[model samples]
Target: MGAPGGYGTGFALIVVLFILLVIVGAGILRF
Candidate 1:
């Protein structure tokens, strides 16, 4: 628990990017 803020920030960013990628991927597949 030395740097929870830093770790949480990175994890949040990865999760957001992953969700965005999934959404974009589905959109491409639909078309």
Candidate 2:
């Protein structure tokens, strides 16, 4: 149970980071 929770948290963090990167890249390209 603990392992699954940790894995899910890590996956969420990675997804958030990926989204931020994509938004930043889009903003830079627009400007």
Report RMSD (Å) for each prediction in the order shown.
Answer: 1.7, 2.5
* Model 1 lDDT tens row, 1-31: 6879989999999999999999999999998
Q: Show where candidate 1 strays beyond 4 Å.
A: 1-3
Give candidate 2 regions above 4 Å deviation.
1-3
TM-score on alpha carbons, each prediction: 0.85, 0.87
Q: Model 2 compared with the native: what TM-score?
A: 0.87
Best by lDDT: 1
